[model samples]
Target: MTELAPDAGFRGNEKLKGALLQHAALSPAGLSERLFGLLFSGLVYAQIWEDPEVDMQAMDLSEGHRIVTIGSGGCNMLAYLSRRPASIDVVDLNPNHIALNRLKLAAFRHLPDHASVRRLLGEQAVRTNARMYDRHIAPNLDAATRRHWEARGVTGRRRISVFNRNIYRTGLLGRFITIGHLIARSHGVRLEELAETRSLREQRMFFDSRVAPLFDKPLIRWLTRRKSSLFGLGIPPQQYDELASLASDGTIAPVLRHRLEKLCCHFLLRDNYFAWQAFLRRYPKAEEGVLPTYLQEQHYHAIRETTDRVTVHHANFTELLARKPAGSVDRYVLLDAQDWMNERQLNDLWTEITRTASEGARVIFRTAAEDSILNGKLAPDLLDQWHYQAERSHALNTQDRSAIYGGFHIYEKRPA
Candidate 1:
């Protein structure tokens, strides 16, 4: 919010297009890229999929460390405040994401108490949220961010009204989950029941009995074959290719099934909020289950006190990094953005990362496939400056509760 210049809405959309539109206008892949860009230009993730707890562990975050990260849904960035970082520089190509990060920071600074914050962001659908936004949150927001919330959505409601409804069910990812639920219901499967499972055994039983079979359905299988069908999951054309290649049969169903299994069975539903979003379409009640770190009560005061340390920029990661002084940042959270990059973009990003990274800096990111995207893609000279913690990455990847990404990677800068 601090560095976002005026007309960011236009500039961010163009930047998003440049990042996503990798092919020509006439080809099938090009068309899919265009379509994805259009949808991605709007609000995509209502809740970020990467598990911030895993991220914190991988980065070994310490007090007073400077961090740079992609601002998706804004939860993880705020959650990082709990570690007492000296500062956090958040960059994103989506204006909606920029507005959202700013809004969340303002909510922390202005909202009266923890319950007020929770009701607005956690219990997102309460009617009082709109009133709360107008009374407490709105006045504190920067003009660009305030305008973003006041803008009307396709439903002809001010975007802020999404809180009055189910905010989690309104974004592109939210709509995607809704469609998944509808499809499952059409087959007479209730995904919500997975949330009620008492044990991992019960979770596996639910998946084996109610969920896994859907992947084998002809309609479901065919739909998975289409790259566009996954745009809601924020999978772009290049990433779709990476994910499809992971399956021995050259299809995405198996990969989807594998990730969904991890989400359903590997983690307890009582603890994983990502599963709650996927199945229940909203976070559980405080008395019922867990919430993201930023939304939890214990972290509220810490985050609010440190809200001033965050700066949201409507810009590309590499571009933002290029502006920073050498050896300045201690941690980097890419959050799967490299999966969208080509060879040149990857190199440009790493060049800046290596240039800007502090001694012993750690970088964490996720990928759609079960390997670091940097292997063979990033230039050897730039890549050699960093040491890949393959063993630790594999260990942490398993601990990520979100379970959507195929791999979690950590790279530490070698002593210069």
Candidate 2:
């Protein structure tokens, strides 16, 4: 598997706090921690979770703003490109992520048209992906990224061959969904049938009849309690603790059930691409408007036209910020990455952010719990410079298409 064990975009603060940020791949807290660490160290997310629509709306990007964002799966960076930002800088510590971002950039720059791009990433089972890569995308890629796609994965096949199969269905989240499907089938539940619902009533009935009981299963309950089973979902140990603490009685199962209800019930299956991927493991074909915003046909030309505006870095966000002139950046998208940080690390990150944020800069992030995490950990003097839009945050939380997170916060820099 492609290991990202050290690729988390972490700024190693002194005191080894950044090292503490990622649970050790070899020496975890326990057996569960080790396994979870191993899973996290791989291509954990072939896609990012935080909704880019929500982020874009929060950032108010246009032609002049500069954005420095965490490039999880590189989806959001492409999404940002669609908005015509002056420039976008994407950073990740994960070599796998950096490679993925580079591959995506190469695809946009080289592909002949929209359909070929769609076939390679959207429908899968393309005959010409490797040929296209060799003649077009591959030649444009940097050596490290080209090497990553050419390297063999578990199937004794180069990872790029997954484009000939299903790329979305190949990563850690993909495997996790596959496992959930197997577990559901063992209990006579057909998860895919949930997609057939015609309306909200049908969706709720299907969940009540066919889906809710799966949550109560003794095996699932046991796994959810184990903590490591969550590794596939990209829930690190620290975030898992915050999730457990937010529960009414400090149990994770009910909390998950509530979130799943929002995912499966609150949104229509026809348009909710996240739900489509969760239950079906692949996005809707090109005709459906359910592909990621960056992949959708309407946005294709705009995203491609602006691909040069984005630059990917295999470095920490702080590293990028340190090099920028003071107040050069206009917006930030943290994406619950800070939930992994400790006080000293948080302080260190904010110190740089405070120094580098442009006037009226806005920062957006999500957390595992319903409350903002910066309250106690951040120094009041530093924290006081930004206004936490609590009311707006609560409203946005309800709108986040990804129902996995508990809180969505928007903090704008107070006028200088």
Candidate 3:
């Protein structure tokens, strides 16, 4: 695990509150924001929703390039290692995310082989995973990270035991998916049946017959109208508003329905692990379903060899970038964080990003709506320094297998 400052968890919580508490505490929006902050302070994403393959292609990563990214579940950062980047500085305001990133790095560096790593992370509920952690991964973790895993949860079992019972099914996002499953079941639909899809045609057919009508239900529509309903998705109050704006009826259900359709229909089920996680609640067997790039056997050796290059920090992205030297970073992956930022925060972040960016540095981010968030929000002087790859962004957005986000953007620094 990478070194951490004293009181890192407390500091991370404070930073998260600062970013999320944008409205007055007494107001409905404020209460929603605070509630989200509380839930987000703990584990959220067991697996990041962004498609790292599309991210890698957008960033055009090359050997020795220095990269900076917001670590969610840490999957993408590990995937990035396959390109042999010189260094990766991962920043996140969520302490759990920081711990998760470090734990993953330790797993890659300390675990005996790819199979053990896969069994621990890729599969669901294996009793041997706790033993594997205790025997191999635990001894290698830093004190802070070790304590995070060893600490008991409400179940009186150590947090690390989640690996023994489906880690992906435990987080806020995981629980949200569980709720979605229950709701679908109540309506007489089995979402997991989509996994049996053999082709895109069958996938679309399954979605249309089994999933599409659920959105039209009076209950789902009403639930989506409330901002609090999406808190399980790690979507804050501000982001909820943006997502709601995307719907023609000014309701969130339609927007969600469209994204879900893409997830179910845009790619082959065998090829999209995101779909596997969504419908099956766990990745399928190696031969039956696709896995993230980092977990694949072909890249395991390379990722493990490069694990030492990653440094995990529990801090705000803008603040971390401010501490770095100018023109030092070659790639930036924002991962939908800008949706939570106010105008001032947006400007502050872009200032540091522009200052730290190397020549031709490429920056990628996602938005809740189908357009770049920077157009009117960021200062012209700052925004003008980068060239938006509108055509490429649209193309890559379509290729993103996660299919949850409305837009995927790529911006390249212009010549001085």
lDDT of each: 0.89, 0.80, 0.90
Encode model 2's per-residue lDDT on 1-416: one tens digit a residue. 12342333233212223324354445555444445545655576787888898898888877889899998888899988888888898877666677888888888889999887777767767877877777889878777778788887576987888788787886788898899999999999988998678898898998889888888888888888867788788787888998989666535888788888888888787777888888888887645438888888888998899999888875676667888889899999888878878787788888889899999999999998889999898999999999999998998888877788899999999997
- Whose lDDT is higher: candidate 1's or candidate 3's? 3
Cα-lDDT of candidate 1: 0.89
Q: After superposition, how far is residue 393 of candidate 1 from its true place, in Å?
A: 0.5
- What's the TM-score of each model vs. the native? 0.97, 0.92, 0.97
TM-score of 1: 0.97
TM-score of 3: 0.97
lDDT of 2 at 135: 82
lDDT of 1 by residue, 1-416 (tens): 23544234433566788787788899998888888887887789878899999999998887889999999899999899998899999999888888888888888899999998888889855888988899998888888888888888677888888888888997789999999999999999989888678998999999999999999988888899889999999998999999998877656999999999999999888899999999999898977689899989899889999999998898899889988999999999999999999999999999999999999999999999998999998888998899999999999999999999999999999999
Candidate 3, after superposition: displacement of residue 311 in Å? 0.3
Which lDDT value does model 3 have at 293? 92
lDDT of 3: 0.90
Error of 2 at 248 (Å): 5.1
Question: Could you tell me how far off, in angstroms, the CA of residue 394 lies in candidate 2 after the best superposition?
Answer: 1.5
As for candidate 3, its clashing pairs are none
Error of 1 at 151 (Å): 1.9
